[model samples]
Target: MAQPTVTDIRAYVLRGGGADYHDQQGTHWIDDHIATPMSRYPEYRESRRSFGLNVLGTLVVVVEASDGSTGFAVTTGGEPAAWIVERHLSRFVLGAPVTALERIWDQMYSATLFYGRKGLVLNAISGVDLALWDLLGAVRQEPVHEMIGGAVRDEQRFYATGARPDLAVRMGFLGGKLPLHHGPAEGAEGLAANLALLADMRAAAGPDAWLAYDCWMSLDTDYALRLARGAAEHGLRWIEEPLPPDDYWGYQKLRKALPPGTLLTTGEHEATRWGFRMLAEMGCADILQPDVGWCGGLSELLRITAIADAHGLLVVPHGSSVYSYHFAVTRHNSPFSEFLMMAPAADEVVPMFHPQLLDEPVPTDGRLSVSTLDKPGFGVRLDPGLPLHRPYPR
Candidate 1:
């Protein structure tokens, strides 16, 4: 059979919630009092959105093939991402073969080197790359996990990231990761509050629940060490993203300084294989958490996983919903996945990227059977009637 070639690529931007999971309204726990780099300024400390965390909405990319199959994906990067896709990246994708993911990715990356290496540009590249994978899966009539390799296990398990680890435990997750509510700038009182919350959560979750804290790049080396020591007494499993993603030296220092048995993890904001290579080779983290949507998509994630596997590190990708789920199932190094609790009070289960995707699967009892993803591509569809705006016209 002749291979299908890419005929067109389209990019659209959506406001509110979608792939931009942070773009939520009215008291979502994710934005409330979570420790962030901006926490140093008391004004932005109360809410991440206060510092424009949700300003960049969702970027939706659609790739159409000559065989009449279209595959789409959503990521964080609103109008600017759409503009990059249509004005620049689309040239690399427009005439490529459907299976030329690597070449297309390389072209996009190499061409944008002067302006793109991480952050928004990589987000745009990741969206395009993911849409290509979805397109390939549609053409092959296989799920993305199957495209990569078959699942190592029958089902995928999850640990929830939320305000209520106690509720998540009842919901059947292996454990719960709580957001670190205070940063270094908050001082001793804030540190005490953070430890108190962890103790309370541990009390509610009881012993045996794997409790962890996601600091979200908001702490200094000294504060991270102090928090790890304080949290260790409460049975903290790991401290995630304690410092900014680029602080490999700090990571190396903090990882060694952490209380024995408490793991230091980072990299939800890191991108590409080269970046992950630095994490692994430098012993910067015990686990790697790359968000497939923002970390160069599946094409780059495969390489990232290989680097992790070689270094004997676990590749627990940061939550990007199905994009993470599909990739997680196929990797032996990935024993479980992270699910972000979208429920406002963290009391119920809801789709992580609500209202944007139709048929997006949620874990039943904190587990998703591989069968839930048996449908072609990522096995999720976007609502055709969604109010998506095409910000950049080709």
Candidate 2:
């Protein structure tokens, strides 16, 4: 059978939480007192939004084939990303065959290398790549996992990321990852407060439930080591992203120094196989956590995972919702996926990209059956009611 060529590519930006889960309204645990790079300033310490964390909004990409079938994806990159898509990346996508993903991804990445080896441009490329995968799956009438490789397991287990680990334990999750609420700038007092909170959570969650801290790239190597030691008493399973994504030296030191039970993990903000290679080869982290929406999408992720597999490292993608779900179930190394509790209080299992997507699946009792993802593509539709704006059109 002949594959349809790409006919049109549309890029749109939307405000509020979708793929940019941080672009949420009102007071949410993800933003409240979460440690960050900007936490050195007293003004920005109280809220992440105070520093424009949500400035990127959401980038939506739609790839249309000559057969009139369209596949779309959402990621964090607002108007600036839409401009990159319509004015630049679309050239490689339009008129290409639906299955020409590797060529399309290479062209998009190479063309933008001068300005974008990482960050926003990569986010845009990831959006387009994911949409292309969706397009390929649609054209072939198959789910994405089937296209890449068949599922290795019948179900995908999940660990919840939120403020309420106790609630997540009750929800049947394998574990809960809490955001580290303080940073190095806060000093010893902050460290005490951090440990105290963990102790309280450990009491609430009980001893056997897996509990971990998501440092979110907000701690120093020394502080992270200290935090790990303090957390070891509470049986902390892991200390994730304690230092910034690029600090391989710090990661190497911290990983070696961490308590016996605590694993060192990072890489959500890191992009591409090249970047991840640094992490794997350097022995920087035990488990690599790349966001499919930011780490060059599924195409590059295939490469990243292969590298991890070679290095004997696990590739657990950060909160990418269904994008992670499809990939997780297929890979043996990705034994479980993450579910970011979107409920304002972090008390319930809301769809990770709520209001922006329809037919999105959430883990029932902390597990998603492979059958739940049997539908074609990613098995979800964009909520047409979203207030998406086209900043640039081609």
Candidate 3:
């Protein structure tokens, strides 16, 4: 039988009640820190939710094959991604052989160079790339991991990221990484408060459970050093994204200054193999955390992981849910995955994407069974009930 060709590429902007799951005042990364613009001013921080700041929106990409088999994926991009998909990327996808994803990705990346080498364009590209992988998996009647290289591990253990580490411990998570709630702008008092919170979580999580801090790209070198130093006594496994992602020199310095056993991790906001190359070459971090959704999807993540592996660095992807789960289980470097506690109170293991996706898998006892993801493609379907908007209607 002849291979199926992509007949159409369609992008949808999904927005509505369930879209803004992270929009709550305390839910955002910035809200945890007082120095960020969103939290700097009392009025803004207090009224963020009421001001309509919590917009849970995403861009969903669907690739339809000549044989009517459809594969789809979603990313954090909103209306802008929809425009790029419909106006610019569609040409690279439509009528192309589903097996030519590598060529298609290169064409799309090269063609968008004038306007995009990173950020939103890459996000849009990521959505499309993932959809292609899903399409190929469905067409070949194989899971994505099997299509790529097959599993390296039978199941994936996970660490919970949220307000409660004690609860995570009770639930059997490997560890808990808390969002740091202070920054340099808050001065010494804030720094003290930051350590106090970690200490509390440490006491609750006990000595053996892995405890880490997610600085959320809000701290300077000095602030991060102080926190890491303070956290060491409490048994911090690592400190993540303390400095801005672009501050390579800062990262190098921070890595050097940190305690010998303390690990520095970044790359959740970084993109592509080239960007990660900088991190590995400079010795900027001990672990690399690339979000498959944001770091050019699984296609690029495979490249990024290879680069990290060559350097003996770990590639624990940020909270990309199942997108990261499939890849994590297949690689030795990605020993554990991150499960963002998306329940309104951060108390339950609800689907990370919530109402936007159906049949989405959630970790049980802080681990996910590999067998659950054996279904063709990524194994989750877009919830049709969630209204999809085509912003740039053709």
Candidate 4:
């Protein structure tokens, strides 16, 4: 047998696209789209699509060898995720064993216990962990999930989010998710308007369909309670991030208060399995929404989902089904995925979805399946030599 050779662990950073920067960043008048980052350049047009904002920040890692075999992986999306990858993960992951991905994750996660753990540390690990997976797959000539454990399904269900009432119809999602924007007043009227939006989406999506919404960490406990009650009336599958991620009691309390089956979904900003375990212990959310890019990548996500399952909860990842899309399909229980409601308009600044995805099959009848990924490593790549980042200080 011939020995497999690895050349170097490479890194790249993708920031906002320049052409769409104005639309992706400058606009704040709109509700949920403001201040939030884009993931890729816009591939198509929709009514609510921002004219300016673009994909915010993502990190891609390539593991290369002498034979031209390559492994590629990316951090899930979040504001500080890039810094985590550059400052911490790159240094720790220089010479890891491709066969022991989970072991390396355990060592790195615990190594930063004194100085880092939850937020930034985990975000960095998320990116590097992904790279390790890519390397493992490419080195051994196997799909990532196949090495760890075979996938649970071929395709995963997804909901058409971020699209407008009219355009959402055409996108063909199994369900629909919308942002619950702060409304005209802080009292009953505001509550009424929020409920009205859910109603409108429900009507637009039709009675047989499912609906969900997020507070985007903007609502208070009292408001979250009111909104959850309203959501019950509309038969929502869940109400996501009803309050800030920090409010553990709020999540738990809301979970208890809401009518059965109207779920409390959160953890998009949490850092590790510890935070999610806390939520799981208290019985907070019915659906634990972990962002792979933010929570320390696949390593932590696997741990987090295990905890969610132990507590008899479901996992609904937060994204347009790129990283999480593939991951969720591998899990027998990843029930749903998210779509952005509105995004940065600029093509140059915010990275948008790949144009090929527009034609891929969406979850039409309330189900999502993983698409086939035959390419080596993590199975996705980025344009070379663009958005050059400063060399990793490590």
Candidate 5:
């Protein structure tokens, strides 16, 4: 029996240019239109715009005894997810052992503890953890799914919830998740429109498939209540980020208030399983949406899912989505995973380690196969086939 010792961890900083900076700017402008006054708080962005460098990261894990045998993983911080990784993270990663992924994750987390306890730091660790997993698989000669455990289902069923409802229906993806068309910042009208849209999507998706929608915290107590009530008949499975991520009580209320059948879930931006534990203790959500990178990578995701499992909740690891399919398949309790309706221009801009194969207008079956690693470690390769350019000065 041989166990491989981790050799070194390298942070490959990937960057690229050309994006729908204008379109993203337009979307943020809409948010700015309504949420501007709320920005009296300092947490708002520069000039209230959301367009920036879309850095995609992957952790290249190397083993002591293996050559030409290391592996990689995805850490997608779409838009600005890269700057946070390279500017602050790469230093912490160099010289670390690949096998100490979870431990190294803690060290990196501790380093970033003073400032970014949740968002950027954990997201970076996610990339590292995944890379380690890929490396572990390659070094040990196994698939990531094999190392994590085994497949829960022969094939994972996914929902392209990132799609607009009607468009998703047209694509034949019965299960679809909708984004926040409006938010609490917009007041009652926003709430009203969301509820109506939920109804329309449910009618379109019909009874058998799952139809989920994101609140993206556009809802306050009253708004969530209103939409939750109206959304009952439409057969909506779950509503995501219905309120602010910190609003645990709001989720508790929504969980109880929204008819008993409606499932509540979140955790896309939440950083660690510690946050998830709180949500679990409070009965905050019916499901947990720990993003791999944000939630401290697969290490914490497994722990968070365990907590969610104890709480009788389902775990749905949210985006940095490139890794979701494989992670979902690996987890025994992962019920579903999500994907963007259409691959982002960033995928073309920044050469992500893992290149997506399905470029259909939409996923016909709502499922995509994660690259099956025959070697050790997670085998994500950022072989970007797009016209690469310098997205930033550095």
Candidate 6:
């Protein structure tokens, strides 16, 4: 039988809550009282609440097969990514075999070379690649994990990323990663506050539960070292992404400067295998946290995982919900998954992609059963009730 080809590719920009739901609001790095690097801007400094910069609207990609079957995936690229998919990427996708995911990914990456090696272009490719995986899984009548080599473990453990580490501990999570509310720009007082917060969380989380800080790439080498040293007394599992992803030299310095046994992790914003190769070669981090949706999808992430495994590094992908969950359950290197608290207060469990995706699964007591993902593809379906706008409308 002839292979089923991709008939059409479409990108939809999804935003705003539907009739029954209000727009989801959440806090960000800049929202903290401390003076962040973003505070340098008059608009941000004068009224931080007004800056809705962290509100990354969603971009949904749909790939249709010749058999009338369709698959879709979502990421935080919004209108710009929609444009990339509609204008630049559709050519590479249309009429391609549903199983030709790697080829399609390579073509998209190469076609956008001049303007798109990373960032939004990669995000677009990642979304499309994920959609292709979903399509193939549906066509094969199997789940994504099976298609990727089946489950390495029957159950997957998870850590919670939110304001309430104590709450996470109560929920039976293995660990809790709190966002750093202060940056270097806040000076000594800010540093003190940051340490104090960690200290409080450590106390609340107790002695056995793991505790970590996500600096969100806002700190300098000096700031990170100071934070790590301060956090050491509290038993910080690791300091994550203190500096920018591109600063390999800084990462090396930070790793060297860290107190003994303190680990460094990054790559949530990094893309592709080459970027992760730099992370491994430079000895930049003890762990790599690549978001599969942002890091060239599952195809490229498998390669990234191999590199991390070879280098003796842990691959705890940044919070991509189910996309990471599927990959995590199948990789030995990815021992735990990250669940970003989407609840308004960050105190309760809620679907990570709430309102946008239906049939999405959330961890029960900080652990997810791989059996829940037995459904074909990524095991989540888009909410048809939610409006999806095609900005480019090809």
lDDT of 3 by residue, 124-230 (tens): 99999999999988898788988888898888999998878888888999888887777777678988998898899888889899898887777889888989998
Give the Å shift of residue 377 in candidate 5: 3.3
What's the TM-score of every candidate structure?
0.99, 0.99, 0.94, 0.80, 0.76, 0.94
Candidate 1, run of 10 with poorest lDDT: 16-25
lDDT of each: 0.93, 0.93, 0.84, 0.61, 0.58, 0.84
- Give the Cα error of residue 93 in candidate 1, in Å: 0.8
Off by over 4 Å in 6: 16-23, 26-36, 39-52
Q: Write the per-residue lDDT of candidate 2 for residues 1-394, one digit (tens) a residue.
A: 8879999999999888878899988889988899999999999999989999999999999989999899999999999999999999999999999989999999999999999999999999999999999988888889999988989999999989999999999999987999999899999999999999999999999988889999988999889989999999999999999888889989998898888879988899999999999999999999999999999999999999999999999989999999989998999899999999999999989999988999999999999999999988998999988888998998
* Model 1 lDDT per residue over 255-356, tens place: 988898999888899999999999999999999999999999999999999999999999999999999899999888999999999888889989998889
Identify the superior model by TM-score, candidate 2 or candidate 4: 2
Q: Backbone collision count in every prediction? A: 0, 0, 2, 48, 17, 0
lDDT of 2 at 272: 91
CA RMSD, predictions in order: 0.7, 0.7, 2.3, 6.2, 5.6, 2.7
Better of 1 and 6 by lDDT: 1
1-394 per-residue lDDT for model 6 (tens digits): 7889999989998775311112344553224443334644545643334565435578899988998888999887888888999998999999999988888988999999899888888998999999999998888778899989888997888888877889999998987888777676667887899889988988888998889988767788988898999889999999999888899999987898799978899998999999999999899999999988889999999999999999999999988877888899989898888888767566888888888888988999888999999998998899988777887978
* lDDT of each residue in 1-394, candidate 4, tens digit only: 5544444665555554321112333443232332122211232212124533334455555666556666666553333555555555555555544556776687778777887776656656766677777776777777666655767766555565552532454455566666565532345765787788778777766776767776667676777777777778788877778677888988888788887778788888786888899989998888888877678777778888899888998887766345576577677668556654334321111123432122223344435444455545556555554555634533
Q: Which residue pairs of candidate 6 clash? A: none
Candidate achieving the largest lDDT:
1
